[model samples]
Target: MKARWIITAVSAALFFGGSLLTSLRDPWFQNLQRPDWLTFEFLIPFIWIFVWACATISAIIVWERSSKRSRPWYLMGIYAAIALLTSIYSPIVVEFRSLIGGLIVGGLATVLVYILAFLVKPISQKASWLFLPYALWGPIGTYLTWLLIQLNPGVS
Candidate 1:
């Protein structure tokens, strides 16, 4: 139990810090011409709050739903998958500046989270809690993607 808590806390911190660092340092991210509606300065804090809140709620849900016997692997797998997919899609979505493409990727990711929630039947309710913020962010991200496409129509 103690180890699980430690792992969760560490993982959450790493994920949050890594995201912040990337946003702060990535040239492509910093140089991109964002739409008027998409403000990075404001979005960063919002994203940080959202990520931490989701992580906390998800950790609680995992503790309540899964046993020590299986929780670590489950949590690790979920977080890893999310990180991998986001890493792959984020740059492409930004670089390509395609509204449809970004929407497809973000939409699929959102759907996958919902699907995972259903698959974990015993914890589906709590899983929904874990993913609700992400789900909400998906549409906002899609909107930003669309705006990016509008702002940089020639990018691809």
Candidate 2:
């Protein structure tokens, strides 16, 4: 459906564009005592593109599979929550420059993803499964961010 693609496109754009617009490659980021494993800073955008792709596909499936009566609820609840979490992650971490704060909030976001994954499984298993990639990225990135923050403690 035209509307489905439009919804997916808009959500993907907001998730990816909003993240890309965050304070990236700043002087502060450059100076962080990043670990050897964190060397692939250049790979973040690509990773995010992949992650958002999964999310977009999952959104389409979820939207299509939801019953007519429940379609609006899925859009407003799961989709909105996903959008909020995806959009806030970078800004919150960048604003505080603190892994502790990031861990707390990012942890919540990750859990919400799992919750949504479970909620959508009965609607569409593929939709639920698609959340896996997005969920997988969270902990690894959170840990790497933790390492960076711990190694470079000057910032709040």
TM-scores for candidates 1 onward, in order = 0.63, 0.84
Give the per-residue lDDT digits (tens) of candidate 2, residues 120-156.
8888899889988878997887777677667877664
* Model 1: CA > 4 A from native: 1-3, 24-33, 39-41, 68-76, 87-108
Number of backbone-clashing residue pairs for each candidate, in the order shown: 0, 0
Residues 1-156, model 1: lDDT tens digits: 575576567656555644544443456555657866554566756774675467456655665667757664665466556544544454445455444665676666666666655555465466556677776676676667666666666763
What is the lDDT, from 0 to 100, of the residue 40 in candidate 2? 76
RMSD of 1: 4.1
The 10 consecutive residues of candidate 2 with the worst lDDT sum are 70-79
True-vs-predicted CA distance for residue 152, candidate 2, Å: 1.8
Q: Per-candidate RMSD vs. true structure?
A: 4.1, 2.3
- C-alpha local distance difference test of each model: 0.58, 0.74
- The whole-model C-alpha lDDT of candidate 1 against the native structure comes to 0.58
